[model samples]
Target: MAKQEAKFDLYVFHRSYFCGKMMAYMRYKQIPCNTIYATLDKHGSDIASNTGLRQMPCVRTPEEQWLQDTTPMMDWFEERFPQAPVVPTDPVVGFLTRLLEDYADEWMWRPSIYYRWHTKEDRTLYKKLFVDELLGGFWAIGGPVSWLAGKLVHRHQEEKFLSGDGLTKANRKHVEAVYINTLDRLETIFQKQPYLLGSHPSLADFGFFGSMFWHFSNDPTSNRIMQERAPGVYEWVARLWNATSTKLGEVKFDYVVGQVPEGWEPLLRDACEAYLPYLSENAQHFEKGSKRFDWNVQGFLYPGVHVSPYRVWCRERLQGFLNALSESDQNRVREILEPMGGWKPLTSNAHIQSNWDPEGIAPLCKPQKLPLMYKLKSRFTGSNHVRTRRAWMKD
Candidate 1:
């Protein structure tokens, strides 16, 4: 008997950064896969039915199993096709890459979605492009729900983003700042090397790129910030998806810290303040000391929040990512990430299960009864601060 050819297909939204993430990996690995454009109409529902989730960037496998979410889907691919590895051979670096990717995927997505869906001007531009650039091909096949479908999907995401509490102006400001700060840091970080992981691109690069490349870079307000604030970083972001490159000057790599130019600090600091709650929530999750916690137990608001041991552990996880590389790479990551001190010493000693099935990421595998919510609190402890010494080895 002859072996059956593998059937690989992606149901995606062209403007979606996660979709782009999957596409980048597919292209990099040279994986043979079919592409299907999913919109907000019946067809979109059809795609969602196949995936058992409304969120996109889903994959239909050779055996016709629908896999949703980027991480699990990517893990599936890594397991199936181990030849062209997206992860580094060094354990620490690989772990860091995954951690950063998670942060990038979850933290940064709010701003990209908000800017695209909320801001009137951005929404207009995006809608026009969706019907023309994104759905042009699908339209040829009589897919008329491009704009409506997109709006429906955007509305769904909006509900989720605004679900926990009504998205306030302060929330918008903070979310926007997340992108700017991330880009500022990314600009400096990438200046030290060609990719986030030194010589080669890792999941972190794509993770950041997922939002940065399509959403921010494409938007006028955010793009101006990226360009004027950190041109090199902005340019480098484009380079991740091969969207931008140098043609004349000799390429160089020299690491530097706190190198953000004048006039950018206020933007970055504002963003930092906005990000505190989200970071705080991450910390609080671990502090709850529950072996397993819902990914969204805490609301990403800008008010009083609690620190969890989980945040510290994750911070250490970031350091672990750096430790994967050679001494030089470790130095590079430390220099770039240390100044922030988001993951410093912790005051609490809490026991949390480290296993994926038993702890932090376990919710992703099982069903949940209710959505997680967090109310503002008056006091918080340093327990959420994770020191560098407590880092774990990526399994």
Candidate 2:
């Protein structure tokens, strides 16, 4: 066991944000696992045969069990490997950690993609990397086929993500502003503390790592901004990457209202104002079966935001965590979240009728559905806002 062996098969894409999240977590726990590179064409059939979808960052255990979805996958790992835990022990702290984690995991996702493809240099690099990953075995990488593949990916991604997600000239700057504001806040926090909450990396840190490490800090556009603007946050990316569980001491989010880390408020405020509200909108659109609808996140009007059933489930998950809390703990959490504008969304009944993951057996079992579309034809979907099988997509 170099680092720490778990005999786990982690199927991953090098640049996938969720993969980066898993990488940071497994590294933190000192879990030695093998990463098996997976693409829809080469590995889709076998993966879909097991998990019902071809979402990457999915893991195959030593016992040959398949697991998908990072939220539940982390739950599975936390239950199994509770050493040097990233999750807080106290119920109130635990719930808060999960809330921040969900925000970073879902809310920061679009902005992360915005940095990746919107930037000319990073987009070109990612397209080249994508070609090598997908078409490397077909021929010499810089050849005509590779060139065509890269071009196809760039076009497909721009169409599917950029225009499809409604990233327009008017709001593109707003998207970047969100990211920069996050960096500014995080930089301030890291200057005061080693991790987001404290010295040990919490679930919140790993969640942010999904986007920051994989996309923002790595991309040339945001990377430069990070290096110059928020060097502390930039340093944190590597720190978390190399972090070991040995340094993970007692975890705490139980501090009373005034005693909690001051840095958390801004992030949580944005989550309350931006992420939770967006989730509410997504749930509404999903209920209406709208293909795309207009919504303003943090005051930026995104006209064609895709309605995600999965995010509706995300809202449910948050509400579940909140409901499970004791009255006292719930009140304590409210002292923090209520003033920040998050309490209402977690408590309000939006008539969300999603039957997904009913058994609470996530990461152990998968439901028979896809996140966005049930099928997509494109050979390369890196799992941004949509995930599905490519087998029937080409049809």
Candidate 3:
């Protein structure tokens, strides 16, 4: 008898950015998987039961274990599959790839959310799409109630990301700047090669694909810009979406490992310039128990941005990776990043010293406190130091 093929079940939503990330990576790797759209009724309940959370784009492995978080899922699959590895083997290139991935995962999220929900056309479009996907055929027959439900769904997103400190008038320019500039830079890269690193897609490609595929390329307003301004990028997104197992294998073998592409440096520099300072300030504020943090990017002040402890953990994770390199590897990475203005933040001590829990619960940031003698000395010296700590929610 023929053996049954191994396969995994992927729970995802069409409009989810992270879901796009996972889908892109899975396609690139040619993993045999079944895609289950996580709707509001029964499939959503199943996902919640499996993961204990409502997070979309989760994978249920053949071992019966359910997993979430696109980054870690990619890592786990890379180890298991070992064919067409997304991460570079060279320490410097690997670290840079991971840094870019982190930037895309956390920083670009603001603009993705903004472009999706901040506009009437895109918001209405997404609401109807989501309603159709979530409610399935009932949406058409339900009539007025379905329309109200879709509106409620759209309003929920607007309240959570649009009306809040997420996409304010004061910071809209900065957010837009990040998206446009990133596209410009990526277009330059794609002009030279098929993928971000070379002929094959890497972690960096999948990272940006999360936002670029779902938000920038799919949203009406942003899609127009992508087609007109960066046709290369739009084409690349299509290529990634339709990649086959044979094509991935061919591209993977065609490229050499440890070789950084031509336009990667400038993109890395841009990420450093745009995201490092924001991350540093976030760490400082989260350490101080503040729910909101603010900073200036590209000479514009973004005030009252909500503090995210999860991002603080991401910063710490980047630092830990940098610190783990061998001395020679670390120096090599520094040489590449130093001129780009990324060295300091990458090497600096995290203001919020924290670690991820074993079971992946809330990451607890350790509070720093002065010794009795130091406190007494500070009192005499009139220092205004105060102690604070907070726990980050599980992503």
TM-score of each model, paired residue for residue: 0.61, 0.89, 0.85
Candidate 3: tens digits of C-alpha lDDT, residues 223-259: 9999999999999999888875566564442233344
Candidate 1 structure quality by residue, lDDT tens digits, 132-171? 5443444324245555645643454454454332456655
What is the lDDT of every predicted structure here? 0.53, 0.77, 0.73
What ordering of candidates by lDDT runs from best to worst?
Answer: 2, 3, 1
Stretches off by above 4 angstroms in model 3 are 135-141, 250-260, 354-395
CA deviation > 4 Å runs, candidate 1: 1-7, 40-42, 127-159, 162-166, 243-395
Minimal lDDT window, size 10, model 3: 378-387
Off by over 4 Å in 2: 1-6, 39-41, 139-141, 247-259, 366-378, 382-395
Whole-model lDDT, model 3: 0.73
For model 1, state the Cα shift of residue 332 in Å: 15
TM-score for model 3?
A: 0.85
Pick by lDDT: 1 or 2, better one: 2
For candidate 1, the 10 contiguous residues with the lowest summed lDDT are 375-384
